[model samples]
Target: MSDKDSESISDAELDRQAEVWEKIAHRPEFEKLLTAKARFIVPACVFFLVYYFALVVLVGWFPELSKKRIGPANLAYWFAFSQFFMAWIVAWIYVRAAGRFDRLSDELLGEHAQPSETPEK
Candidate 1:
């Protein structure tokens, strides 16, 4: 595309858009969205990290307990394998939670969006 065509919005239009977004950013709905996301994300992250590291700690500190076999694999192996399932479960939960977050975001943006004035080519 030529530069003229590529440059869609004028600087003034861009400035107006920035101001609209600035206003949106200060709204209570924006704060609610951020807080909701952080609430879910922080706990999920901490839980996963603790679960992941517990295996290492168990193997190092209680080798006998971790080495006790159940079929062909030991406790450590089972624990490690379970982490895969844990990760998948976490991902599933996050996906469900993210749908709610996205809806809230969409509503927030819809409420704040200004009518576009398309610059003619």
Candidate 2:
């Protein structure tokens, strides 16, 4: 085959692949997933930042809150330990939100439909 013919074939294949990808990307279910991700990510980010800053401010401004007496551990060390608890709380919140989002998307997409029954059934 001529070089031109091979180039045309490659172009056609590329176009076909692009169209398939476009369709998949534009599917309603895919769009819903994207929306759900955006919803989860934005709020989770805000919450994480707020929680982190609050922890920092509380540790800096409130000595009583950070006070600690576990052997050589200082108030800052205890406060740092509490930050892990806050991290777990944020993780739980994110997981819950993501689960809710997934459920909503599945419902919206009618993903709970059972498989088609055979004539024998």
Candidate 3:
């Protein structure tokens, strides 16, 4: 969406799109997508932040936890590995959720896009 693209649209078409956008804002599917994304993203962000904060605190205040050896590697190594694991898990979750979001977005666009306003290959 660019200013030039919007500028090419007639006032009536712009108004129509605005109305469509307003309706899309109220649509259950759009709302559901938002809620679902928030549910996944908020927790994931919080979990990552907490993990990061804990790591900082542990390394700063308590060095013994990171020193404890689980195998050939220490607890710090395992913690570092867990960060990578958590990142991969979040990426996987986002990729899965993105498909759902795209579907919902396409459905919304289908309801709104006029023949000319819609892109043509």
Candidate 4:
């Protein structure tokens, strides 16, 4: 084919791809998944930020938490220990929320399916 013909073919292909993408983007299932992801992401991020800031503020405003103690340890060290517990709690909360969100999302997006029937052993 001539250069002009090849260029026209390429342009047509690009337009076709764009149309296909537009259709996919407008599909209900795609929108639902996007919404679900946003729901999970936004809350998780908020929780993480709030949790971190709370710890920082607590340590900054509470002098007892920063005081030194025996055994080369300080109040900050003990407060940091408590922060580890907070980390565990946050992690657990995130896992539970993400799992529940995933299950609901699968239902909403019509991605989950039951297993096939099987005979007893």
Best-matching candidate per TM-score = 1
| TM-score of each predicted structure versus truth | 0.74, 0.51, 0.72, 0.50
What Cα-based lDDT does every candidate model obtain?
Answer: 0.86, 0.70, 0.78, 0.65
Residues 1-121 of candidate 2: C-alpha lDDT, one tens digit per residue: 2244435556677676567657656777777778888978888788778867876887789788667667688766766777789789878887988887778677744753334311111
Residue ranges of candidate 4 with Cα displaced over 4 Å: 1-12, 64-79, 89-121
How well is each residue in 25-69 modelled by candidate 4, as lDDT tens digits? 666766776776688778877876786777677678977756868
lDDT of 3 by residue, 2-120 (tens): 54666777999778768756775777877877887788889888988998788778777878888999988988878878888888887898899889888978886687556665443
Clashes of each: 0, 0, 0, 0
Pairs with steric clashes in candidate 4: none
Model 3 stretches with alpha carbons more than 4 Å out: 4-20, 115-121
TM-score of 4: 0.50
Output the better candidate (2/4) by TM-score.
2
Q: After superposition, how far is residue 29 of candidate 1 from its true place, in Å?
A: 1.0
Rank list by TM-score: 1, 3, 2, 4
lDDT of 1: 0.86
Global lDDT for candidate 3? 0.78
